[model samples]
Target: MIVFDLACQPAGHRFEGWFGSSEDFAAQKERGLVACPQCGSHDVEKAVMAPRVGRKGNQSGTRNATSPARTPVASEALPPEVAQAMQKLARMQGEALKNSRWVGDDFAEQSRAMHYGERERETIHGEATAEEAHALIDEGIEVAPLPFPVAPPDETN
Candidate 1:
């Protein structure tokens, strides 16, 4: 299923509607099957949405953006030394995360808390924007990114 951010034109209340595809959303809206959750307004349209795309082949199946599928780049495209080093680094990160907590999208907030002594410091791994990571580093908070992405726990089982 696909989810779209919807907004009521009259009331301007934003909400989400799930459908099987883009056509599904259009059909429902045309049929007045979609309505604003806040004011029960039927004059709803698509709202601004955040890009939700993540690493390719995410086990979570939470694709936020679609890209034209492309052929896989072969390992032969990289220097042998680089490929070896990357493989080694990926394994190391996977092992390290065995003891680290998955903080999801709250990495910046949680890491800052530890830096400011608002919370106890512990190993954590999570998704963080480049800006958020830089901010934490600027604040003298120690944060490092994983060499490889790990599937979210919720989607792993």
Candidate 2:
């Protein structure tokens, strides 16, 4: 997988996008499949990024006072309306998941079973690979990615 730093137009909300290749990113963008996770905008473009070079082993690990600081907080980086919308969306997702069953890695199988009437239909959520999701869709089974990543029930504190 390859990761690209992406920025949405107008809002300029920066995020990372992973694709199979650079051409894959281009194709997704052309097809309007590439969207900002924060604002759901399709007008996204690659953002400038510095090379990820490692420090020399002998170099000191201390930072100079003149060095740049970390990125701003989420609220500071986003417009008030956008931030509010995002918070609302997050709350909605949490509420939706409260009624959904965590099926873990059996997402694809459970989804297929339900689609073929082998299993009872109910609200379910879990993890699936991109290819698995595509295959499910190709077989006429409706599936959607969650707006936010969810930790497995077992992994929670």
Candidate 3:
């Protein structure tokens, strides 16, 4: 799965859209399936985003140009409590999905089957385009996305 920075053409609201692949995003956009969450506009397109890269040399005293112009913040800007809580949440998620099936990009189909009673319900997780996820929600399907993305087993290489 991949995430793209998206913008609403009408309102110019910038947001993120997750997709199984670039083609999935294109197909959804072609069908006018993606809408801006802020303004409910379907005229959405990919927005320019800076790639996240690690610091070159050391983390001593350096700031990237992309960061908003402001006084330098120490690494401790994020409270230790908040950081620890986030780590705990990640561990909990990992444990929860230890036995879940990785259905890769067939998430929408598999979820719909279970939702319509065409297949028995079971624990499963996989990738789906933002539009697909929204569609499932609209159909009252009990599907949800993981807080953090997992690498597909087959693509781990």
Clashes of each: 0, 0, 0
Q: How close is candidate 3 to the true structure, as a TM-score?
A: 0.52
Q: How far is candidate 1 from the true structure (C-alpha RMSD, Å)?
A: 17.4
Tens digit of lDDT per residue, candidate 2, span 1-157? 7889999997999998899999989866764578887777889999999765668999889877898978876533777887898799899999999999999889999999999999899999987777888899999999998765677999899
Top model number, lDDT: 2
Q: How much lDDT does each candidate structure score?
A: 0.77, 0.85, 0.80
Candidate 3: global Cα-lDDT? 0.80
* lDDT by residue (tens digit), candidate 1, 76-116: 25566767887898888878988999988898999989888
Model 3 per-residue lDDT tens digits across residues 1-157: 7889999988798888899999989976764567776665889999999875556675756566787876865432446776677689889888978878988889999999998899998989887877888899999987765645577787777
- Per-model TM-score, in order, reads 0.48, 0.60, 0.52
Model 3 poorest ten-residue lDDT run: 73-82
Candidate number achieving the greatest TM-score relative to the actual structure: 2
